[model samples]
Target: MTKTVQLLQEQFRHLRMTEVANELPVLLRNAEKMSWTYQEILQEILTYELKRREEKNVEKRLKWARFPYYKTLNEFNIEEQAALSTRQLNQLRELNWLDQQYNIILLGPPGAGKTFLAIGLGIDAIQRGYKVVFSTMGELVQLLKTEEYIQKSKVQLKRLREADLVIIDDLMYMAMDQREANLFFYLINHLYEQSSIIITSNKGPEQWVELMGDQGITTAILDRLLHRVEVIQLNENDSWRLKHRSTIFN
Candidate 1:
């Protein structure tokens, strides 16, 4: 029996069914105990291999996403955000707009759940088999600046360009010179119409010119980004972080 099992495992591995090879013993045992038919045994083996492949694919995509943290849409507190309603949030989760390559701009003060919402949507997208990438504006700029000289930057930017949804956090948080603004514009141009974007920022598009420091570049960037976009303004009330801060004494 052991020799037979080993031979079967070796054959499965040679056929590139590594997952099935590893689980062959357990599956064989279950099949024997349950008296599964030949057809049932074949179905079980194919299903198990496909399921394991999907699980591994999801894991690979999540790692490629490089999210600061994993937070699902269900974890979001809709009650805390007056700007967005439950129905609207559900609509976003449906991802119809994402499928149409529409952009989403999340505007609000610090800790207004802009980043949290963006991250949540990104995670949801990943689960749905969409390629997603997360990068702060600062990190994106750095990546753009060094992409030519740094192999790591090149790889990261390649992933960004291939992503279905790109989330840029804290956009226009600092002023950028001509070169930086130009680099940023080229990236947006490449992604324009080909992919959707979710931008989280304290300042709106109207205020982006001030930080970009170049009217022409800012206008060009806005032209592509606002072409098919939804702007959601979050609440201006007390910071969500402050309201939910953990007390040391407690």
Candidate 2:
């Protein structure tokens, strides 16, 4: 029986069924003790392996998303934000908007949970089997400004194109020069209808005109983005960071 098990392990490795190969022996013993039939044992083993594979895929997708930190809708305390509508929050959670390539723009004061919501939705999208990428406005511009400008930009842009969702956090946090504005326009243009974007900004659309400093570029970027967008304004009374600041001491 030992030799037979060893041979089966070698065959399982060749078949790339590592999870089953490792866990089957213990499960088989449990099955015997439980008086499980052959078909029942086989079903349980397959179910276990399939579940592990699904979890592994979710982990891989989350890693590729490049989220600075992890957050979830459960972590968001909706009760505190009286201004936000429960219906709208539920709609966003449904993820149907992403299927239609609609953009989600979150405008609010600093630390009002815009970034948290964006990251949470991104993590949700990954779990639902959609590819996602997260980048800050400054990081994206720096990527475009690298030494191998053309080649590097191409590779980075391709990454965005391949994703089902692209999250741009802190969209108007820093001043944007003409070059940065132009680069941003180009990126937005490519992703226009091809993929969904989630933008978290401290400034609203009206404020972006002065933020970009170029009307043409600003208009162009907004035109494509706002065409099929859901504008969410998070108007909580106080910053979540400030409210939760004392929790660490507790």
Candidate 3:
């Protein structure tokens, strides 16, 4: 409420230090109460601003990612999913593969944790300051087809192109026509070596050609995806969703 405090806040706003500006009053009160030195106060303000900015950046990236749901690696039942060990999960979290632009292919049947795992990795990547985008195979195809004409689609595709990692869920869930197959291939080609990819699919690579309906297109797609990729097959006998489904009577 003091004139000096108001002036300081205005200066911070002018410098685009909005986070510090808003918290300046509280910070000053804490400093006074603690009898903090000038250096300590300055360090605290800078740390707070940096932390808030990182959090906001994560939020923005998460919005752009467009995950169907939020899930963390911690929530994944490692015991239930026998394929990926805790050590493997920890390694994945290190994100060295992502930094090296390596791709990940998660294969499993319906209700398996493939999608969940992909989303968890994507979330972790975002928190670590990487841009990520998530779209189902069907949604990606539609977006690619419409990008030329639709403004929203263009925006979405732009984000996808600029992302450090892209997650495509339910790949080859259905057969694609010649045109659809071509579009998908082109997108994959564009992202090849430029960004890491995480793909979740119920079908294996051998089965992908059948769904694509074009051996040549499938071959080209596979070439880029398999060039530097880690394939993990989730072979859990029971579906995680089915096991956790709530019953009305219960």
Candidate 4:
């Protein structure tokens, strides 16, 4: 490499512009061949580096989100779930609801795509530069319980509060003790009106009363959640997992 090029690479590295450092040589050659103006060449380089950095940031946020699987709205079968309005779903992709701190409750039977929709929306939020965290109800409760003793729970809770959206999947898949319930409620209380939440549950609000096993506390929890919420019920008859179960054995 030329001394000038090497120095430029070092400067780019110092600035953490790995993309520019790596692509500068090829881009320079192209600019030379195309007889581009100095201003045009500079704009091209800056645009490419900025796009690369944005993509990397999105990837990092998605990694931190911990989605169960990578799914997008394009992969979802909107036709199969006719109950969901196409226009509304498209609007959701715009992510304006996050600004409104609206909670989305997806209720349906098992394998009805509740989790899939939640993960898809979480991915969308990450792509739009919104911080997101995805965890199963049990997993989050376990984290809170384990960290509660060491006072790490408060630190962890503070971190979660920074997210624009928090996705809780498969809630009420298992019953919780009084302590667990309290921990869960604490999280809800903290995030309430401060951040948006997307939850997938096999049980509906009425059924949650029994699952929680404490009507009074459950009522308090539900009150905050439902105060500004969009309830989407996906009542497909067949389970997508079951339909695709043969793929694993095959």
Q: Pick the candidate with the highest lDDT.
A: 1
Q: How far is candidate 1 from the true structure (C-alpha RMSD, Å)?
A: 1.1
The digit string of per-residue lDDT tens for model 1 on 1-250 reads 5999999999999999999999999999999999999999999999999999889988999999999988787988899999999999999999999999999999999999999999999988988999999999999999999999999999999999999999999996778989999999999999999999999999999999998998899999999999999999999885888888899885
Q: Per-residue lDDT tens digits of candidate 3, residues 198-234?
A: 9998888988999889889999999999999999999
The best candidate by TM-score is 3
- Each candidate structure's TM-score, on Cα atoms with residue i matched to residue i, is 0.97, 0.91, 0.98, 0.92
Per-residue lDDT of 48-156 in model 4, one digit per residue for the tens?
A: 8999999999988887787878989888777667668788789878888889999999988898888888888888888888999888888788788888465655655
lDDT of 3 at 249: 84
Clashes of each: 0, 0, 0, 0
Off by over 4 Å in 4: 149-158, 244-250
What count of clashes does model 1 give? 0
Q: Lowest summed lDDT over 10 consecutive residues: which window, candidate 1? A: 236-245
lDDT of 2 by residue, 79-122 (tens): 76766777877888899999999999998898798989899899
Candidate-wise lDDT, in order: 0.95, 0.86, 0.94, 0.85
Candidate 4 residue-wise lDDT at 151? 68
Per-candidate alpha-carbon RMSD to the true structure:
1.1, 2.3, 0.9, 2.1
> Distance (Å) between predicted and true CA of 128, model 3?
0.5
Better of 2 and 3 by lDDT: 3
Alpha-carbon runs more than 4 Å astray in model 1: none
Off by over 4 Å in 3: none
